[model samples]
Target: MRPQLLALLARAPAYGYELKQGLEQTFGPAYPQPNIGQIYVTLGRLEKGGLIRGQEVAQDGRPDKKVYEITEEGIQELAEWFAAPTEGPRVRDEFFMKLVLAPGTELADQLTLINNQRRHCLTMMRGLNRLAAEEQGNRVSQLLIEGAVLHLQADLDWLERCQEELT
Candidate 1:
């Protein structure tokens, strides 16, 4: 959230409400929208950290609003973030733990666990595919949905591998 807001501020100075609206417009409904309170809290933290500076502007018949602009340090940080490669998805250890420890616990059947997980993945993939279809006009949302579907497909494949190994 910090980096995202910093990047937005790098574009132009904006009040918290403007930034919130901008994010929703840019990402559409695919991205979770942060409440105004969350935005202000983040802005306060950024101002304290010196990544952004806020100036209170007076308006007739309205409350004064603090507009935020990114500092030089924020620009450098944003540049670094753009240059850095994102880390790959991590495998959840909870599932692995369940698979390995099921025999010791009352959950003695690992096959059932795998089957249930596979079913869940398939159901999720179907929903994501439907969402992707609905978002076909929006490339960003479509891409996000496609990525989710691919990950779920990989999970399903991994479940099959786990079943083979365990059996």
Candidate 2:
């Protein structure tokens, strides 16, 4: 879980559903999306830590909804979280594991997967660049978008290099 929970909460006072939607959409359509149980659990943990204050919102069709607002401590926690270094990223590469375990996984199929990935990365890179272009005068958002684009660009370049090496 990201330590920036409070900062994320501060973006808007939100319920579990809203937070899940925002976080899952943050990186666009590139990766696996987050689930509702995960979001609710995180919110519960944050609430226990006093990082957020919850208010019950009345709903006509159902039970009350719990809305979370960031607290002062949560903001401080976010700052600390931002400053901390993450360990080597946790990767859930079931596909890669299968490739390793199943040595005879056909080379053609593997190549197809790699090619598809490159196409997806290229598409995302193009989209990020287009969005950045639209924010020409907004240096901060443009820079942030450009940074994301660069990450995609680097990955695409690496994939191209790998293909060259393999061939």
Give the candidate number with the greatest lDDT. 1
User: Backbone clashes in each candidate structure, one number apiece?
Assistant: 0, 0
lDDT (C-alpha) at residue 125 in model 1: 86
* Candidate RMSDs in order: 1.9, 5.5
Which residues of candidate 2, in runs, are more than 4 Å off? Answer: 1-5, 8-45, 55-76, 87-103
Question: Stretches of candidate 1 above 4 Å error?
Answer: none
Write down the worst ten-residue block by lDDT for model 1. Answer: 23-32
Residue 154 miss distance in model 1 (angstroms)? 1.0
Inter-residue clash pairs, candidate 1: none
lDDT of each: 0.88, 0.71
Report the C-alpha lDDT of model 2 over 72-142, residue by residue, as the tens digit.
Answer: 98888888878888775336555445434443655535556568778988888888777766666666566
| Residue-by-residue lDDT tens digits, candidate 1, 82-147 | 999998767666887889889868856899999988899999888887776777778777777777
User: Which structure among the candidates has the greatest TM-score?
Assistant: 1
- Tell how far residue 88 is off in model 2, in angstroms: 5.8
**lDDT of model number 1:** 0.88
